[model samples]
Target chain A: NTSELASHELASHELASHDRTTFNPTTEHLTFAARVAWRNAARCVGRGYWPALAVRDLRHISEPQQVFRELQRHLRQAWNGGRIRSTISVFGPGVRILNDQLIRYAGYPDGLGDPQNRRLTAELTALGWSPPVQRSDFDVLPVAIETGGRTQLFEWQADDVQEVAIVHPEVGDLGLRWHALPVISNMELRFAGLTYACAPFNGWYMETEIGARNLADQGRYDRLPELAQRLGLDTARERSLWRDRALVELNRAVLHSFDAAGVRLDDHHSLTRQFVAFEERERAAGRRVNGQWDWLIPPLSPATTPVWARSYREDRELTPGFFHSRRSAF
Target chain B: NTSELASHELASHELASHDRTTFNPTTEHLTFAARVAWRNAARCVGRGYWPALAVRDLRHISEPQQVFRELQRHLRQAWNGGRIRSTISVFGPGVRILNDQLIRYAGYPDGLGDPQNRRLTAELTALGWSPPVQRSDFDVLPVAIETGGRTQLFEWQADDVQEVAIVHPEVGDLGLRWHALPVISNMELRFAGLTYACAPFNGWYMETEIGARNLADQGRYDRLPELAQRLGLDTARERSLWRDRALVELNRAVLHSFDAAGVRLDDHHSLTRQFVAFEERERAAGRRVNGQWDWLIPPLSPATTPVWARSYREDRELTPGFFHSRRSAF
Candidate 1:
């Protein structure tokens, strides 16, 4: 909650200088900061496309309703009919949202209903947002916006959200779809010693992020076994490496579907090549590229990538970049 | 080289007490030291079977020819017709062998011939050891035993080595074979401040030590692409995860072949379970188990093992343990 600001604290601060009120950055500065933030993202492999980042400056608005409307616009513009563009929308400082992302799958009381949306679904339901139908796995969660000492919910527009249907011969529809834009909403942006608490950013997905980790990790979608079974790989023994085989197919389907839909996503090999180029450019500029080796390496075929062989400096200084805020238990 | 000792320094010590002459350990002490050495092997996952170690004390002999004969005996006893057992042969101190292992594949000048053993083959060939016929992939390397300040080569007997045939339907017999026991020939065994520099040790294989790294690593056999092609995996695309699928199957073949041949080997799952039990036993005995997290976790299906989740103390302490001697460049 924004707490005392809207309740009584604003009265005492009303006589303060206008510098505090004009602390929010202009559109040009916001755009530059967003681009630099992308460049400084140590774990991102797609930083070669940093110059293409689009920034939406919504820092002038303080209302939760208006913030949500801008978020809808950001999603629609970034989605771009599957040709996803890296984008960010900066809501004004002092407003906070507890959720990490603007969209997430919800969990239900029964078995994992919408494997991705469960927690966010509960959070939205607790905030008195009603679903039009029984919750599904692909449900897009409403944004939890806190401003002026109060928290409110804003439902996403159906027209603004675009999902690519995963295509596979044996797997059928499976109803698997990821919201086009992954708007990281809860991270704070620190630039020139000023903190923007509600800056949401987006980038085009790397296929491995969706296929290898999200879909294959046991605690997440856990789709490997199902995919393996559908593909007729022997699942009775671990030696069969059914999981590994299925993981490849799952990743293949993701890349194929995204490419077929014309979404701007990268495969691991191309990303590794781009990262190598990024390293060379950083070296040419007399800057040592700092990165986390584990994060920089792709999940699948890790040994094949050059990033796996090299060491990286763990420089986690927070300035002109994004930093994770204190997470709220959902 | 023994240097001063062979050049008349022994004459001065010859008049000294027999205590200096008989510095070699007794058979019982050798057995105890061998067990402790296996327990201290940081990279080994089969240490739970340390109690069953069979030690061959050949410390009484100092001749290179005699040492080679004993090495043959060690191989046969350790091989034991595919029901392999952990074993070690303690060669007398003051003798240094240049080769790392008693057996290795011969690498030819042509493309990727016997990827694991080429260097040892060259070393032996330089010392006037001739191949009986055209050099094969699974060439049993001759022991280069150094004694009396001189190094000599000793060829292994045909009856001493045993190999399990890998049975994979698609790959057929690619002529891949490994010596029944991995006789680590150059490590020093330090017990109660006593250093035995030429104490060779052997242990049963952990399938991944063969299949995952030795065969699958790019610098080694690198059989994944061949296996993938044979298995009809789509190698044209990285997203297909063909390499990962082939790796799993290769690991499976290793486990299957070892089990079929009645060789005393363990799969990663069983090894992990045994390691967990070993940890518990160590805890119960008031000893904290020292292990390397990276070495303990198997390469194939690493996350599925408990060893991957836990941390280990990096213990480099060297008492009652085996240590690698300075390696001679081949």
Candidate 2:
């Protein structure tokens, strides 16, 4: 039964087995738990697809090198020739991934690449990972995994990853691109009184996540001012709304590029609508949908979305959920 | 000293005076209290000008007709011939204003103008107020004041009110205009354990309040879709970013119109910068700035502003503040 087991009962089982690290579940239960965890993710806007998550039970693999190999395989399989499928690869306890995400761009000290990854890049560099001769903005960072007090580094072949080169429908090319699959590696999945610390999971990209936030945010790519300049907008005046205009254009480019590449990506409008429908379905099934209002609303033109007007239960104590790992990469 | 007094101590003074309705303070205390109330308004983004607020002490005026006359004068004086001044006119206790705002457009059953005021419009209509034969969208509603259980309706002369007709910088007239002053009449101003029930306060417009919310919200004017059609934008595709583009243009129109009309208006950028400076100054003075982040961030291109990155104390129990009246108009 996939029901709540008392923590004390689980503790007694751990004592009987003499192995606190191992808490095994049936394959069916593990898959169902992973799906339920996705459904319970309050900050995710794509909960409608939680039922479709394919759970890979790789708990038998404890070696660092083997776990890294499975991660590479997870990337390629999840890519699925760009009809990207939501997937998760679960490893045993004591298996730790040092990257926040399975795939992220390396950031240099001189600020050439993604600034969000600067600390992680430095950590990987200190751990004896070598960079390419020429560094670019989209250089993929090497995957680092630790198991049984030993750590190892692994790199993916270019064919394993899928990336969309952003080009606006109206403004041909501004030379921007983002990875298709976003496998969050640093979250622990808790289910039935047990924690799976290396359950790297992913869904398809939401266009605004890449456009309105990743590239458009002042701290990240900080591309709006440059994009405004390229578009010959009046950047000197805030009344001109040059930043808003540039944001829209940049988001448009991301959507157009994803569509051209046939990579599955959701625009904010469709995704929010889907989220509302999911909310309704959960309510119909006698389940309360908990959500953070700020996270649920899209960053661009938030008031236009249905979620902007709707309020959900802000505080929830849900079990069988994905939570931030105690051991964070940064 | 304008320090916090015990509520029981004020109650004891009320018993000794045999007048519970009146709590008189020095003129200087009243002015300072009004200024501090503006500063402590957590939702306000223009608190940088809190010190410059012109407080008019009309506490002695308690008759209904006399209150109406003073309100009319407050509007004209605060308008200041387009260079609007932040002003407040305080009336004694037991005085109630039926209108939420001193100047707001009436909404007809056919949804002609300001659906937010529909209930108030019906209430006023029932109270023997007459609508114009040609009820245009810009028709101002009559102000209703109640004192001694006698409610009187008063209308402002056309010269007393200042309105800005919205026109775009590039695109010409769209037949949209808004009143210059926003004097919130229903909220109570409390200071030193006494409540001023009819203290109307005025502040100049933030263009986003007009452009992004009042006109752009779906339940409000919903002018964006029509504006987008008129601007020749493709509305079929959500990825075209039609809403974002239209929002920017509408905000641009508001900014351009106010500047052209010589009206005092704050664009979101300059106002947010001013808010950040106010926050710093408050910190330097050893006072925590309490703020609601949702209200502080402008509706248009919010992440482009400095307030987007800052955090503030969300909860506080401060005296000498303006609060929503328990006796609401609607």
Best by TM-score: 2
* lDDT of each candidate versus the true structure: 0.72, 0.85
Best by lDDT: 2
lDDT of 2 at A246: 93
The residue-by-residue lDDT of candidate 2 on B1-330, one tens digit each, is 223334334533543565435646766667877888888998999999987899999889888888888988898899888889999999876789989899999988898988888888898898888999999887899998987787788888898778999998888998999999999998888866778889999999999999998889988888999999988998999877788889889998999999999999999889999999999988886788979887888877677789877876665457578888777855
Which lDDT tens digits does candidate 1 get at residues B104-176? Answer: 7667656445655667777778888787587566666677877666778777777877777776645666456
Q: Which residue ranges in model 1 land beyond 4 Å of their true spot?
A: A1-42, A57-62, A113-126, A129-133, A170-175, A190-194, A318-321, A326-330, B1-63, B114-125, B129-133, B147-149, B186-196, B273-291, B304-313, B318-330
TM-score of predicted structure 1:
0.79
lDDT (C-alpha) at residue A47 in model 1 = 84
lDDT of 1 by residue, A39-133 (tens): 78888888888778988787787678788788888888888877788888887756888667877666666646445556767777888877658
lDDT of 2: 0.85
